[model samples]
Target: MSKDQVLDPGAIAARLADLPAWKEADGWIVRTYRTHSWKGTLMVINTVGHLAEAAWHHPDLTASYAWVEVRLTTHSAKGLTEKDFALARKIEEVVGWQPGLEGGALEGTPSDPRFAYIKHGR
Candidate 1:
Protein backbone atom coordinates (compact mmCIF):
# COMPACT_ATOMS: atom_id res chain seq x y z
CA MET A 1 0.00 0.00 0.00
CA SER A 2 1.41 3.32 -0.99
CA LYS A 3 1.33 5.92 1.72
CA ASP A 4 0.27 8.53 -0.84
CA GLN A 5 -2.86 6.77 -2.08
CA VAL A 6 -6.17 7.69 -0.46
CA LEU A 7 -8.76 4.94 -0.46
CA ASP A 8 -12.23 5.65 -1.82
CA PRO A 9 -15.39 4.55 -0.04
CA GLY A 10 -15.56 1.24 -1.85
CA ALA A 11 -11.95 0.47 -1.15
CA ILE A 12 -12.38 1.56 2.45
CA ALA A 13 -15.38 -0.70 2.82
CA ALA A 14 -13.48 -3.63 1.38
CA ARG A 15 -10.64 -3.15 3.79
CA LEU A 16 -12.97 -2.62 6.71
CA ALA A 17 -14.67 -5.92 5.99
CA ASP A 18 -11.49 -7.67 7.00
CA LEU A 19 -11.10 -5.52 10.08
CA PRO A 20 -14.34 -6.14 11.89
CA ALA A 21 -13.17 -4.76 15.20
CA TRP A 22 -12.44 -1.40 13.64
CA LYS A 23 -14.84 1.11 12.18
CA GLU A 24 -14.51 4.15 10.01
CA ALA A 25 -15.30 7.11 12.23
CA ASP A 26 -14.86 10.83 11.64
CA GLY A 27 -12.62 10.07 8.65
CA TRP A 28 -10.43 7.60 10.48
CA ILE A 29 -10.44 3.85 11.15
CA VAL A 30 -10.64 3.41 14.87
CA ARG A 31 -10.48 0.68 17.51
CA THR A 32 -10.56 0.85 21.27
CA TYR A 33 -8.64 -1.75 23.31
CA ARG A 34 -9.71 -2.46 26.85
CA THR A 35 -7.15 -3.49 29.41
CA HIS A 36 -7.43 -4.85 32.92
CA SER A 37 -5.40 -2.21 34.67
CA TRP A 38 -3.35 0.93 34.21
CA LYS A 39 -0.42 -1.31 33.42
CA GLY A 40 -2.36 -3.04 30.69
CA THR A 41 -3.28 0.30 29.15
CA LEU A 42 0.34 1.39 29.04
CA MET A 43 1.29 -1.96 27.59
CA VAL A 44 -1.18 -1.49 24.78
CA ILE A 45 0.03 2.03 24.07
CA ASN A 46 3.61 0.90 23.98
CA THR A 47 2.83 -2.03 21.74
CA VAL A 48 0.89 0.21 19.37
CA GLY A 49 3.72 2.70 19.26
CA HIS A 50 6.15 -0.04 18.43
CA LEU A 51 3.97 -1.32 15.62
CA ALA A 52 3.42 2.18 14.25
CA GLU A 53 7.09 2.88 14.35
CA ALA A 54 7.95 -0.35 12.61
CA ALA A 55 5.35 0.24 9.91
CA TRP A 56 6.14 3.93 9.56
CA HIS A 57 2.42 4.64 9.67
CA HIS A 58 1.28 6.17 12.92
CA PRO A 59 -2.14 6.15 14.57
CA ASP A 60 -3.62 8.73 16.89
CA LEU A 61 -3.87 7.24 20.36
CA THR A 62 -6.06 8.28 23.26
CA ALA A 63 -5.31 6.28 26.37
CA SER A 64 -6.77 6.39 29.84
CA TYR A 65 -6.16 4.17 32.84
CA ALA A 66 -7.66 1.03 31.32
CA TRP A 67 -8.25 1.57 27.65
CA VAL A 68 -6.58 2.95 24.57
CA GLU A 69 -8.29 4.13 21.46
CA VAL A 70 -6.30 3.99 18.23
CA ARG A 71 -7.30 6.00 15.20
CA LEU A 72 -5.50 5.47 11.92
CA THR A 73 -5.42 7.54 8.76
CA THR A 74 -2.85 8.64 6.24
CA HIS A 75 -2.21 12.20 7.31
CA SER A 76 -0.27 13.01 4.18
CA ALA A 77 -2.94 11.55 1.95
CA LYS A 78 -5.63 13.55 3.76
CA GLY A 79 -7.93 10.53 3.85
CA LEU A 80 -8.13 6.83 4.54
CA THR A 81 -5.63 4.72 2.65
CA GLU A 82 -4.22 1.23 2.31
CA LYS A 83 -1.45 2.07 4.69
CA ASP A 84 -4.00 2.76 7.36
CA PHE A 85 -5.60 -0.62 6.89
CA ALA A 86 -2.27 -2.36 6.82
CA LEU A 87 -1.29 -0.80 10.08
CA ALA A 88 -4.65 -1.54 11.58
CA ARG A 89 -4.30 -5.20 10.70
CA LYS A 90 -0.89 -5.36 12.26
CA ILE A 91 -2.24 -3.67 15.37
CA GLU A 92 -5.09 -6.13 15.66
CA GLU A 93 -2.61 -8.99 15.59
CA VAL A 94 -0.67 -7.61 18.54
CA VAL A 95 -3.56 -6.15 20.46
CA GLY A 96 -5.41 -9.43 20.63
CA TRP A 97 -2.43 -11.03 22.30
CA GLN A 98 -2.78 -13.44 25.22
CA PRO A 99 0.37 -14.64 26.97
CA GLY A 100 1.26 -18.27 26.20
CA LEU A 101 -1.93 -18.52 24.24
CA GLU A 102 -3.15 -17.94 20.71
CA GLY A 103 -5.75 -15.21 21.18
CA GLY A 104 -7.44 -17.10 23.96
CA ALA A 105 -9.21 -14.15 25.60
CA LEU A 106 -8.82 -10.46 26.25
CA GLU A 107 -6.49 -9.61 29.07
CA GLY A 108 -8.45 -8.05 31.92
CA THR A 109 -10.05 -8.79 35.22
CA PRO A 110 -13.79 -9.47 35.24
CA SER A 111 -14.32 -7.23 38.24
CA ASP A 112 -13.40 -4.03 36.42
CA PRO A 113 -16.14 -1.48 35.88
CA ARG A 114 -18.11 -1.99 32.67
CA PHE A 115 -18.08 1.67 31.71
CA ALA A 116 -17.77 3.03 28.22
CA TYR A 117 -14.18 3.94 28.88
CA ILE A 118 -13.49 0.51 30.27
CA LYS A 119 -13.97 -1.86 27.38
CA HIS A 120 -14.88 -5.51 27.91
CA GLY A 121 -11.94 -7.94 28.31
CA ARG A 122 -9.89 -4.89 29.16
Candidate 2:
Protein backbone atom coordinates (compact mmCIF):
# COMPACT_ATOMS: atom_id res chain seq x y z
CA MET A 1 0.00 0.00 0.00
CA SER A 2 1.03 3.64 -0.41
CA LYS A 3 2.63 5.50 2.47
CA ASP A 4 -0.45 7.55 3.19
CA GLN A 5 -3.00 4.85 2.63
CA VAL A 6 -5.47 4.36 5.50
CA LEU A 7 -5.42 0.95 7.10
CA ASP A 8 -8.63 -1.02 7.31
CA PRO A 9 -9.83 -2.50 10.63
CA GLY A 10 -8.31 -5.92 9.86
CA ALA A 11 -4.97 -4.44 8.91
CA ILE A 12 -4.97 -2.25 11.97
CA ALA A 13 -5.84 -5.19 14.19
CA ALA A 14 -3.04 -7.29 12.71
CA ARG A 15 -0.57 -4.46 13.15
CA LEU A 16 -1.61 -3.96 16.77
CA ALA A 17 -0.51 -7.47 17.63
CA ASP A 18 3.07 -6.29 17.34
CA LEU A 19 2.26 -3.40 19.69
CA PRO A 20 0.68 -4.95 22.70
CA ALA A 21 0.82 -1.73 24.68
CA TRP A 22 -1.22 0.06 22.06
CA LYS A 23 -4.82 -0.23 20.89
CA GLU A 24 -7.03 1.11 18.19
CA ALA A 25 -9.46 3.76 19.49
CA ASP A 26 -11.64 6.00 17.37
CA GLY A 27 -9.34 6.65 14.44
CA TRP A 28 -6.01 6.46 16.22
CA ILE A 29 -3.57 3.98 17.65
CA VAL A 30 -3.02 4.89 21.29
CA ARG A 31 -0.85 3.95 24.25
CA THR A 32 -0.38 5.27 27.75
CA TYR A 33 2.86 5.11 29.72
CA ARG A 34 2.82 5.41 33.46
CA THR A 35 5.72 7.13 35.20
CA HIS A 36 7.05 7.19 38.73
CA SER A 37 6.80 10.95 39.15
CA TRP A 38 6.20 14.29 37.48
CA LYS A 39 9.79 14.32 36.34
CA GLY A 40 9.34 10.98 34.67
CA THR A 41 6.22 12.23 32.96
CA LEU A 42 8.08 15.21 31.53
CA MET A 43 10.89 12.95 30.42
CA VAL A 44 8.44 10.74 28.56
CA ILE A 45 6.91 13.78 26.88
CA ASN A 46 10.24 15.20 25.82
CA THR A 47 11.45 11.86 24.56
CA VAL A 48 8.29 11.50 22.49
CA GLY A 49 8.67 15.03 21.21
CA HIS A 50 12.16 14.35 19.94
CA LEU A 51 11.08 11.17 18.20
CA ALA A 52 8.05 12.83 16.64
CA GLU A 53 10.11 15.78 15.45
CA ALA A 54 12.78 13.57 13.98
CA ALA A 55 10.23 11.40 12.24
CA TRP A 56 8.19 14.44 11.20
CA HIS A 57 5.13 12.50 12.31
CA HIS A 58 3.77 14.08 15.46
CA PRO A 59 1.38 12.42 17.94
CA ASP A 60 -1.17 13.91 20.29
CA LEU A 61 -0.08 13.65 23.93
CA THR A 62 -2.03 13.78 27.14
CA ALA A 63 0.13 14.00 30.25
CA SER A 64 -0.31 14.15 34.00
CA TYR A 65 1.84 13.90 37.11
CA ALA A 66 2.28 10.17 36.63
CA TRP A 67 1.17 9.23 33.15
CA VAL A 68 1.34 10.09 29.48
CA GLU A 69 -1.07 9.03 26.77
CA VAL A 70 0.06 9.05 23.16
CA ARG A 71 -2.44 9.06 20.29
CA LEU A 72 -1.23 8.68 16.74
CA THR A 73 -2.94 8.76 13.35
CA THR A 74 -2.05 10.00 9.88
CA HIS A 75 -3.81 13.31 9.38
CA SER A 76 -3.30 13.27 5.66
CA ALA A 77 -4.73 9.82 5.40
CA LYS A 78 -7.47 10.61 7.93
CA GLY A 79 -6.78 7.34 9.71
CA LEU A 80 -4.12 4.98 11.05
CA THR A 81 -1.23 4.16 8.73
CA GLU A 82 2.21 2.58 8.71
CA LYS A 83 3.73 5.85 9.87
CA ASP A 84 1.71 5.66 13.08
CA PHE A 85 2.74 2.08 13.72
CA ALA A 86 6.39 2.78 12.93
CA LEU A 87 6.60 5.76 15.24
CA ALA A 88 4.75 3.91 17.97
CA ARG A 89 7.28 1.08 17.79
CA LYS A 90 10.17 3.50 18.03
CA ILE A 91 8.62 5.31 20.96
CA GLU A 92 7.95 2.02 22.73
CA GLU A 93 11.52 0.89 22.20
CA VAL A 94 13.22 4.03 23.49
CA VAL A 95 10.81 4.59 26.34
CA GLY A 96 10.94 1.01 27.55
CA TRP A 97 14.68 0.39 27.21
CA GLN A 98 16.49 -0.83 30.32
CA PRO A 99 20.22 -0.86 29.80
CA GLY A 100 20.71 -2.42 33.24
CA LEU A 101 18.87 -5.52 32.07
CA GLU A 102 20.99 -5.63 28.90
CA GLY A 103 24.31 -5.60 30.79
CA GLY A 104 25.53 -2.67 28.73
CA ALA A 105 28.07 0.06 29.43
CA LEU A 106 25.20 2.42 30.04
CA GLU A 107 23.59 1.24 33.22
CA GLY A 108 20.00 2.40 33.18
CA THR A 109 18.54 4.54 35.94
CA PRO A 110 18.96 3.21 39.42
CA SER A 111 16.31 0.96 40.92
CA ASP A 112 16.17 3.22 43.98
CA PRO A 113 12.72 4.75 44.27
CA ARG A 114 14.31 8.18 44.49
CA PHE A 115 15.89 7.71 41.07
CA ALA A 116 13.29 5.52 39.44
CA TYR A 117 11.52 7.04 36.47
CA ILE A 118 9.13 5.25 34.15
CA LYS A 119 6.98 2.47 35.58
CA HIS A 120 7.66 0.27 32.59
CA GLY A 121 4.83 -1.95 31.39
CA ARG A 122 5.28 -5.69 31.73
- Model number with the top TM-score: 2
Error of 1 at 25 (Å): 1.1
Give the C-alpha miss distance for residue 68 in model 2, angstroms: 0.3
lDDT per residue for candidate 1 within 40-121, as digits (tens), equals 7887899999999998988899988878999998898899988898899988877774443434555433443642223435
Segments in model 2 whose C-alpha atoms lie over 4 Å from true places: none
TM-score of 1: 0.79
Query: 71 in model 1: Cα distance from truth in Å?
Result: 0.5
| Top candidate when judged by lDDT against the true structure | 2
Worst 10 residues of 1 by lDDT: 109-118
lDDT of each: 0.80, 0.94
* Local lDDT at 6 for model 1: 88
Alpha-carbon RMSD of each model: 4.6, 0.8
In candidate 1 the C-alpha lDDT for residue 50 amounts to 98
Q: Each prediction's TM-score against the native? A: 0.79, 0.97
